[model samples]
Target: MKSGTVSQDYDKNETDGKVGLKRRLGFFDSLSFLVGTIIGAGIFVSPKGVLEYSQLNIGVALCIWAACGVICILCTLCYAELGSSLPFAGGEYYHVRRGLGPIPAFITIWTLTLFIRPSSNAARALTFAEYVSRPFYSGCPPPELLKKSLAIGILLTLGVINSKSIKLATWVQNIFTILKMMALTLIIVYGFIEFATNPDASKPFQDAFNSQFPNAAQTAEAFFQGLYAYGGWNFLNYMAEEIKNPSKNIPRSVITAMCAVIVFYLLVNISYLTVLTPRELISSAAVSVTWADRMIPSWAWIIPVSVAISIFGSLNGGMFMLGRLNYAGSKEGHLPSLISMLHVRHLTPAPAMIISTLIACIFVIPSDLVSLTNYFSFSSWLLVGLTCVSLIVLRFREPNLERPYKVFLPLAFVVVGVSAFLVLAPIIQSPKVQYFYALLFMFSSIIIYIPFVHFKLKIPYFNKITCYLQLLLEVSPTDMFEDSKTE
Candidate 1:
């Protein structure tokens, strides 16, 4: 594999021919980054929402979650291959740029920096604030300002961690990831033990495939909700440039982390159901904590503390990844290079980190706790569908590019992606929350993109075909006219 190559312009500027590679992140460090990005408050809160839709058939709910996970794994593999071959810092922004075109790619990065990443960070921080205050507030809660203040604090703290040092930030991430996993394992083991000791205590599992199954429309919405719980399976794609060996390590980390999360999610969901009846889980908002309380005495706080830690890690993870995306954009001259400024002493993207944290703080202010999470989930899935389509399009246009981790069944990947896209129609038709958010943020992004290109940056071929294709796949075609033109 080619170890390093500088941009042609950079090489031209150098007096002597010399290209430098960024510092390497080991396999375990990459895995830790993935784990930290995922395993957040969504797992704790989203399950209750899924149970609300999938009531009485716990096994079926678990199965649906597992199915969503499988589809995510397929997409993760596709991204892994793209990331490995191209090995850039910006994650989807890089892939989309290489596969789609500059304009669309710019839009993706713009949306991520301005909206999606901020929304994600805000949601996680808000979740942390809610849990942190729960013990004091009990069933009754605090004033709105207090909650927002706490959320902002959470964002700032995580931003500080990210800006300090990548090594320090990732080390903290690895520790939290391990702790969160252990906490989950404890939940699983304790629940199973309770089930074994008192079989009569558990409720019967639900059968999702029964004839009395909810109508296709209702089932589709439930599946969509289930999909949110498995949303962060692509976290590894964002940190491709940081990995020690992009060609091989990036692919392995993405696939391995996704697969592991899927299994962990499945097992945890099953354990949750085994301990609590579907009816109980559906009704209880804090189902996981309640389950923990029942399994062990004086341990209700354990679940809350653990979940808070997990969410904290997730908040930092999103900021870290999004910081890189913005940093990469600045480096490429697509965005103000000032945003790309690294702390000369620390070598971290402090400006982007602070900016991301600030936006996140803003998002958390107007929104209540629950809407923030749902909004992030809604926007995340819609964009994920867009990104997946970009993947398939890039393949046909750039067939010969090296792929370190290709999706095993290309047609199956396409089918799964298409099915995911189709499912969104029903989800939006039933309740138009995510659709509204998707349109609002995306249109706003386009508005910003037009000016950023026309005025701020003299971007070359902003609407070129190669740029659009790169938006889907990470690799741009060497020859522009190789593929038949669509437009």
Candidate 2:
């Protein structure tokens, strides 16, 4: 049976009395959102997992980095076609629901809302706190209480900014993105100078490929680490409904962000090599901080400060899009109707962001949230592969659908293949208990789906509760978006 989405009714609802999100975001705004989300603490504090799992092989590690970028670009191509055609909020959820069915969509979003996004955001917020708290405790680690408090503060700050004003969020995102680029560019320039003048810089590259070989499982883990650093390539697609001229801007923003990030990442990795040897690079807790100490010991404090600002932008972008995901899901009746609401005056999805923030606050207490990113990658790639499959399914099912930006059909298949490898290689080569746990948790969602979503069971007095909460939150049920379809 074919399934339909409320996105088709967006045009009709736009003229109704309900308030909706505005098309205030342009090409640069969209671009900043993607870059801001992608260039977070992963690059600054982490990346050691990538180097370590690659068996300290500089050549293989660099190849894995480049390969991750290429894989994301392919994924972006599939998203570009969907964004240009569907032009809806919810991104992967909407695309999956449209091409596959509602059951799959609900399960996908259930996992993301319940675990994936909140956990990832919490990890980034904690990374920010680590940098911020480092100065106070010079020799030893910061107190657990202090770190957790600061992480929760970050969540609240960004959540309020997003709920307050779209203009303010966009302004902050652009400024931080430019700052991130400048910071990385400065490292790149300095690294090239060091590599040119210092004879030791060439040592790592001399036998880059001759290092010990990593097993298939190790390689797969390394790839996930690199891809983690390149996460958020599809963030712009999440707000297609909010972007101006989305058919044109989605492609422009995604492509530009990818090229800029890919070049910066490759150069930044090379720069790290110039100062720190392979062992030092892998041993350091924070990659950028160590690089700064080696290159500019007097100003070593600046890198951590800039990295905190970079993560601030990244957290804001993630929260901004997460609200839309909940809103889109609610509009489709998969989630509570309250999540679909917008602020009466601001017209922002404040209720959704607030709820997501509260969930993130819970996740902030767990100190090991960053390591769990690897375990969660199992489900993340599984769903991503499913989303790519949706692209191919939609192509055949809706051949007549207007597609202002059609990518080469083969590109979608490449993403599907890569996603499959990422998901399966670990289990096949060196299965971990986490993989088993991840699979168990993913299927367990079916329990919730069957009772509430599939059977259409209603909670008693849910309507009254929704109404009371709506009034308390000062929000109203609003239409999703204007049909941004461009011929």
Candidate 3:
């Protein structure tokens, strides 16, 4: 592995006498982060899309949800092996670098950090703002400015907390995860109540299997909804270096979290259907809100408050991972070297976190987030599919790479096949101009990477600039390799 943009990731950086990021996350904290990241606004809103796409066939929709969870676990196991063996901050980027090559790796982190991640963070923040501000504007929608401001404020607030202490960030994640889980428990419990007291209301299940199955296209769309909701299944891998006992906990936590999310998702959707029939579920703009309205109109406020809190925890978890991605990229010299530095005393990537939050804030101001999120969505999945492919490549290429948890090669292959379908299905079914643009945008990173990063484009007096940022941010820099430049 000769030095290239991120090829150095395959080997360790010789110690530079500087303190690195402390491993602060235990299994509990790691599980909390994964669960919180996965159960975002998706479960609350996406059930409707799944049901609608599956043509109100409750049985098929449930299967799609379960299928998506299984697919995610398979894909995540492949990452578990990488997280344990490679154990770096960048997650997929590091795995791709070692197994595939530096260019693909650089392209992944670059496109994600620059576009996909920030846009995602922005979407989460905006949703959080809307939920929180809705009460105040019950007469009409809240002013766009109010929502954007609240969105930016929350993003920055989380950034500051992450900057100060990893402990604090994980603590916030844990509390939020618990709170959201409790909310989901309430939903599941009520669904049980609905079944016990009023069997007629649970019509979706009464003759669930009798409804005609959705066509192939509709089934794929339903699965896509599930996949979208399950987006952050791999988030824990990115912070492998920060987790305690990476080998055991990486696989254990990811598996545990996904299982819990699947149960919660399945039960919650079942709960929703118990109260609202297929027509009500599909017709409603928001599934949870409608469920709450019918189930307990007087206590309907609870769901909105819970959703706001859920999004809060999710945003915190996402920002933590987003910051880590930036730090990881910088560590590999794919991003500005300044971002790689850890806080002097706290050993946190405050600069990277803040920069990421700022970019997300910029994205929050946009009025049309759906268009923004859609444009970059396919590329995100494409990279994910490629990362899974890297797992297969590494198994043969580096059989001796000391895997703490080796995934079954066949399961890895299955995930790769599924990933290929997911990455291609939308384009092949109903091609969109944005999909083409996204492909161009994703690969364009290669053109920029070749000269600027791969060649280590030297910046005159960059050392002075790095020193200034280090002093201002109180961060310690990693030792750079001979071929590496400031950025």
Q: What TM-score, over all chains together, does every model reach? A: 0.84, 0.93, 0.94
Residue-level lDDT of model 2, residues 1-487, one tens digit each, is 1123323444343456658776678998999899999999888878788899999989999999999999899899889989877877889988888888887888889888878888888888887898899899989999889999999998998899988888898999999989988888888999999989989888888888999988877888898889989988878877887887777888888999999899889999989988888899888989999999989999888899889989988988988888888878887778898998999988888888888898888888766655665677767777888888989998898777778789999888888888888878767777788878777777788888888887879999998999999999999887544342211
Segments of candidate 2 deviating more than 4 angstroms: 1-18, 210-215, 368-373, 480-487
Best by TM-score: 3
Q: Tell me how many clashing residue pairs each candidate has.
A: 16, 0, 0
Span of 10 residues, lowest total lDDT, candidate 1: 476-485
Model 3: per-residue lDDT, tens digit, 1-487? 2222222342343234445665678899999999998888888866899888888888888888999999888888888887877666888887777678878888898888888888888898889999999999887988889999999999989999999999999999999999999999999999999888995866667678687788899888888888899889889978877776687889899999999999999999999998987888888877899999999999999998889988898889889998999988888778888898888788889889989988988888776753567766667777778888888897887666667688888887787777778778888998888888778878889888888787878779998988898898888885443322232
lDDT comparing candidate 3 with the true structure:
0.83
**Cα error of candidate 3 at position 156, Å:** 0.5
Which of the two candidates, 2 or 3, achieves a greater TM-score against the reference?
A: 3
What is the full ranking by TM-score, best candidate first? 3, 2, 1
Off by over 4 Å in 3: 1-18, 479-487
